[model samples]
Target: MPAIPPRFSVTPEEIDRVVATFYASVREHPGLGPVFAAHVKDWPAHEVKIAAFWRNAILYERGYDGNPMAVHQEAGNVRPGMFDPWLGLFDSVLRHELAPETAAQWSALAHRIGRGLRYGLVEAATLPGGIPKLV
Candidate 1:
């Protein structure tokens, strides 16, 4: 594989554009739209939060500062194993729109997100069964 490019920083405008384009596809994605629809009350607010998240994650400009997992968890949308589709949709968006290097970086981040969500889901699922105490 070719060397990944230097992290290409993103602007709010680019974040907005990318997020809008991404969600357009996401809204059509199987296993994604309904999941989000079941949780999000206002589309515009959700859009803004995601845009900010992208900006902060893809850029070091501190554009997005929301606690994404907390928001989703609070919304009762933290279905066990749901991270697969979440990461999948992001991967699809990166593949459809980003440069190869950019896609690679985004993929790396998405993997982390999926892993975190996976563990969180497992923990949440085990809660009713007496989660083991961490040493």
Candidate 2:
């Protein structure tokens, strides 16, 4: 099992800050910017959704409801190779904005999510008839 943070706690404010900075970085990213810009029409609304996603993920707040896999698959713009830079940016933001331990904890979660998303994308791409539709 992974070691839990004994002295650190994730808060809503921290989640919000991290999400804001991380997405801002993504918005400026050369490869990712156009991809995100093509999809999200409302930046503020997207920010709230992702911030809630991180809060619910790290804090178990159960505030997020959207299906990430479906969303990514539907994005069509997110290729399999893009996860690395996305995770890198996320880790960089966490490391810069939070305590080391807290950042690691958050980064670990991001890594897990990134891996899953990438795996799903890869599998979908390899399917015989293209990605299957989610019910």
Worst 10 residues of 1 by lDDT: 2-11
Among all candidates shown, the one with the greatest TM-score: 2
What residue runs in model 1 are displaced by over 4 Å at the alpha carbon? 1-11, 128-135
Can you give the TM-score per candidate against the true fold? Answer: 0.76, 0.87
lDDT of 2 by residue, 6-117 (tens): 2348788888888889889989999989999999999889999998887677666667899999999999878879999888888899999999999998788789889999
Clashing residue pairs in candidate 1 (N, C-alpha, C atoms within 3 angstroms): none
| Residue 45 Cα positional deviation in candidate 2, in Å, after optimal superposition | 0.7
**lDDT by residue for model 1 (71-111), tens:** 66566656756677777777777777777777777789769
Clashes of each: 0, 0
TM-score of 2: 0.87
When summed lDDT is taken over every stretch of 10 residues in candidate 2, the lowest stretch is 1-10
